[model samples]
Target chain A: MMEQVRVVLDHAGDISPISSEEYLRIGGYQGLKKALEATETIIDTIKASGLRGRGGAGFPTGLKLSFTANTQADQKYIVCNADEGEPGTHKDRIIMVEIPHRLFEGMAIAAVAVGASQGYIYLRAEYPYVATILEQALADARRQGLIGSNIMGSGVDFDIQLFIGAGSYVCGEETALLDSMEGKRGEPRFKPPFPGVQGLWGRPTIINNVETLSNLPAIMVKGPKWFRSMGTERCPGTKLFTLCGNIAHPGVYEFPVGTTIRTLFEEVGGGCPRGKKLMAVQTGGASGNIIPASLLDTPMDIDACAEAGATFGAGDLMFMDEDSCLLDVLENLTEFFEEESCGKCTPCREGNTQLLRLIREFRNGTAQEGDLNLLLELSNVMRGGCLCGLGQSSPNPILSVLRFYPDLFVENSYRKGDLAYA
Target chain B: MTTREEQLCVLEEVAAIAAKWRDRPDMLIPVLHEVQTIAGNCIPKEVAMTVAREMRIPLAQIYSAATFYSFFSLEKRGKVLIRLCRTAPCHVKGTKETLSAFEQALGIKAGETTPDGLFTLEICECIGACDVSPAALVDDTVYGHLTPDKVRELVASLQETEGSR
Candidate 1:
């Protein structure tokens, strides 16, 4: 039996039982209703759950709310980063479209707990379906009195709005997302006066990942311990992994945090398709580095992945089978960064573009010896110098590919005698 | 597979959504979604501009909203739009090869709609149906485990099926 809980998409979607009542029947806002009564206890529950931010850096969700709760800002904003901009990640969008209402419930309760009146879902342009789902959910929430002034008549007023983002991958960064929400280009703004301190219209804004927001109501009802009881110590609850690549099963997978990477491959995904060997896995979209085959036994727990030099950013797992060339794979990711770079910073704009050219030249077997060294040097520069992750983590793919499979980068190209990742 | 009349009906439906929430500047997101679903894709400057005038919102604001969301298409798509997943997961499953095959069969490149208004080839990021490696969505139907051979068969069947319809 599939133990699936579509909290957001309670009754499927627009074609069927697409109403709050239908959602309610399936135990939907029971969490929110429970949350209103247990307002003060919400953060502790989340902290006990050991739930961490799914969007890149795995910061504890409970700690984020705790910081906001203690902050002296007169106005706090509950911002949901729904911009599912990660190349391989689509779990958030799936959850959003399937059940926008659940996310709204999560957002609303979060607003009440954090004492925020305004909420925004900052979605990316790629996911047009989400905007519709979210809009409909907000309407439903308003009509049901789950949103708007005094939600559920609990005297907690919150207005959730949808804010669309331009095609800038950097906006996935919390600060940059805030900047974009402020009617500016989606560029990464520096930290210090972080969004938790000064965000949106310069108030204390707690930007939560869509998945983070989606998980809120559950934490409220279940208690932090109930949530914590599911996963490993320190990394509790379920982390939704958007599995892609040459795997047999490629879709959104919800599993306990410490599930081994091998289990995700052999069991959940049914292993690599076409009998191909799993060479390396790119965990957490582009920012996360490739976990080599030697590390396939590595568990996907937050700290576990982080210890291996990969932040499980939004849990986007991309599996690269043996047959695919590593150089092309690295170049492919670089081109996306180049196309979606936003060009606000010099290192990313110029460096990523040049990186693409250099990679192409190297692939074409025309790379000078110095060019290889130059590529390495340029990657380091782009990583440190760029204002955002698009540029900062740009070298991850190259470095991972280079370290794990140096043979993929022969004197140039795949060597004539090289075996096909046997 | 809608008639021009049905298409126009969708526009009317969109217009109604726009009219209903004209007072709330916040209703822009919903209004756009309904309109886009009706319009097939959001194109024609007039669609947004008309909303701007009727809703009394700035054109800049409408355009900004339209451009920000990925669903709003600014131009006409071919009758059958074939967007293959090109993101990391899809890439792992040889999306490049699938795209190459699509371009090969269509005699066109990425983002190009065929001359007869039949097929448009695009490389979209992982459509999030990663449970099926190397997926391609033809309008709403998702095709997984795509190969160069599958591409040829799909293009052939789509054209034939369109003719029969």
Candidate 2:
């Protein structure tokens, strides 16, 4: 019985999320106060806590802040990636509705740590509701001397503004997010001039996930060792997982990083509604790999999930029942990739379209046996040649499903032209 | 209102929006958002042209930015835009049934507006509410864990609100 170790979600349901007074009653901004006392060691303290970015890519939070800190820029910016567009991942909205001040506090502290004066929260436009909540919370924080100049009389002048995304999933990518923030067509820029080097108006920027930012209050308040004790060595701290789909309890749940998928499905998620046997699980979003029931014992850590052939992207564990068809799931994922390709790179744009066509052909029983090999080759090409993570990781669902369930694809391949080829 | 008068009003609002973000080329999205917010439902051609002129951005760039995101609509939409989640999780858990319910209730298919111009139905991708499978967005309000019956009730409630108005 692994009880949920609530860290990021500490104040989620306990108080009125918009009220700064309620947040202060529960020890909010204490971390920022403590952080301002020794601003010099804030990044080092985060590094010592072993806090990794809760965003898809598990970059070290400390290292990202330090990069922006070291860069000699007159105007630096910190961005909180709230474009929660990844399918099956919705935990950030809970944070937005439950504890928006935590997000503001985290950004304010990051601003102090990295010497940034301005910050932006790039939120998804679909969640216009949460945007209102965040606005209210920002006002509440500002009124209480938490957001504006000389915050709590600490002489740190950091202000944050909310920017709603126009609805591109590619903007969830760090560089693409910066591009979207700049009012450009959201497209991924080439790396080496990473966001930390020359991001957001060609100034050094530190972009972190919404959940990643929310962790700072807890980590800063409690010492590094307290934060490190809960989760595994590499990925310390509890993770917020949006556990949904065909489960008795389909909601946000916080668990230590090393919790097994089996435990999550069986205990927390209640093992599929009405005791239906678990067929498959899509760990992470549509871009995440489809994990078979046999791999349920794998730890939910970033490295462990990668070893199990699924990157723990944004902590979305979508469980499916035995009655659900894998072909239908793959079709949905492929169509999503096709629609969200951004049309920037040829491999992703064309590869995702071709992949969707092949999946549809297979589903319609009009495929050849060679299409599987074609899908594999195309997946490899998209993975290698795509410009951004959107195109690069678009083929993950198809590849992972094919790896785990080859028979499903082969059985579905028996069509009108397949017998002629056979 | 006359078409020319409506166009003039849209231009006036667009100018105000552009002036707010003046000299900040990066604030185009927010400006476009505000323009749409003021204009309601869609960014008119006249408004977009005015934005282009005021912000010194090209018309092609403005159109591309508007068309890029699903939220920014160039064409007119109904007063209440209904975004239904048709992704895998929602699909498996009766999203098609919910869609059918909306179609039956509204007498229009997905992506089509009702004859009265009160509601528009559009299928959106997963909105991160898969936990509450079969979710929908009724003009920024998320309704999750829905069945066909709930969909009908939702439609009825909206109709009631519209009737009262």
Candidate 3:
């Protein structure tokens, strides 16, 4: 049995999330104090910790911070990507609602490292209640001198404001998030000049995920070597996996990055409910690839999952029992991309529309023999041509289904008398 | 339909919200949120124009921002908007039946509002409550683990509260 190893969720249930004193009692903001004392080494220490972004893309945190730190700007900014819009992922919400001070302290550490004075928490519109909790936490932090000007008499003036995102899934994309923060339509900006160099009103900005930032205090308090002791050498630290769908224990579980899918399913999730057999699992969120039950031993790390032709996006594990239809699942996933395409680029807008049509044909038992190839061909086009990550990864579900369960398409389409076009 | 005076009152309320945010172009979404609240759950044309004029932004830009997000509705919605989760996690956990239950209880489909302006039924992509599959957002609060009986009871309670009010 693989028990949870809580690192980011260190003070989740024990502390009052709104109280800064409770957080302080448990040694919160000590990381910021340490970072302040040795400001120059903060970035280097983070780099050595081997922490990566927890917002789907596993970009190295220290590398991202260095980009903004190196850039010469009059006023740089730090933005926390709290827009937890991934379909099955709510780990960031848990971190924000449970241990908001940890997130604030983390942001303050980053702000001090990068010489940034302003910070923004781009919270999603759906979690309005969570926003209130964060708002109170921010006020308490401000009152306690944890945030605001001259934090702990360190002469580092830093403050954070919460910006509520109107409901757009694409806004979860960092560039789109910056555009939305500037009060424009939440369309993703072209990246050549990434947000690290020119972002949020053409100023150098660093946007870190809520979970990634939440890990900073722990990493700062415990040295880099201690941080790297638990997880794999390349991908260090624990991940909060949001387990849901067909499982007995469907909630957030904190485990090391290299944990296997089988341990997650059988030991942690207690297997499928009502003694049903697990047929398939979709790691990551809606945009992640689906893996068949046969490959249950694949380790849940960034490099390992990539080697297994999957992504450990935001660490979401959505299980499916034998009774579930993969075709029906594909249709739901396709429709999501279709509705959320944003229409800024032709490949994503038109590609998702046509992809949904093709998937629907298979679902309705009217798919032609050549339609499957057409689906794969279009997915490749979108993957290569789309402007942002949303469009680029929209076809992940279809591609994975084609890779693992190509027989599902054939079986669903060959139903007797239902094949109108055949 | 609102009278001209009532529309003016809504415009006045929207102007205050715009001013509160300093009429900055970057504060358009926040301003629109307040405008939508005052305009009875939708940003009607006059309210949009009021915001555009107050914020000194192009009406086209305001409309683009409003239409881009699913949260901001251009059309009027019910007093209690029920946004059901339509993602795969919820779908596999029987959200289709939960959706049907909501439709049956409200006497309307997914995109319609009750005749009395009491409730609006809509399907949203995800609210990240998959742990409690078959989840829904009744206004801003989330209700999870829904069933047909639960849906009926929730609708009845909502209607009863509105009746008492």
Q: Identify the candidate with maximal lDDT.
A: 3
**All models, DockQ values?**
0.27, 0.77, 0.85
lDDT of each: 0.75, 0.87, 0.91
Q: What's the lDDT for residue B126 in model 3?
A: 88
**Cα TM-score of candidate 2:** 0.97
Q: Which is superior by DockQ, 1 or 3?
A: 3
What's the lDDT for residue A330 in model 1?
Answer: 77
Clash count of each predicted structure: 12, 0, 0
lDDT of 1 by residue, B20-131 (tens): 8675665676567567655655555757776777677888888775665444567766767777877666776678788888998888899888877677787775465566
lDDT (10s digit) by residue, model 3, range B1-165 = 369899888889888787676658889888888789878899999888878887888899999999999999999898888999999889999998999999998899999999998788999988988888889988878898888888899989988998788
Compare the candidates by DockQ and give the number of the best one: 3
Candidate 3: the clashing residue pairs are none
State the TM-score for model 3: 0.98
Candidate 1 residues lying further than 4 Å off, grouped into runs, are: A1-17, A70-75, A97-99, A129-137, A163-168, A179-184, A410-422, B1-82, B104-107, B116-119, B137-143, B148-165
Query: For candidate 1 chain A, which ten residues in a row score worst on lDDT?
Result: A413-422
Query: How far off is each candidate at the interface, as Cα RMSD in Å?
Result: 4.1, 1.2, 0.7
Model 2 misplaced stretches (Cα beyond 4 Å): A415-417, A420-422, B1-3
TM-score sort, best first: 3, 2, 1
Give the per-residue lDDT digits (tens) of candidate 3, residues A229-333.
Answer: 988888999999989999998989899999998899899999999999999899889999999999899999999999997779999999999999888998998
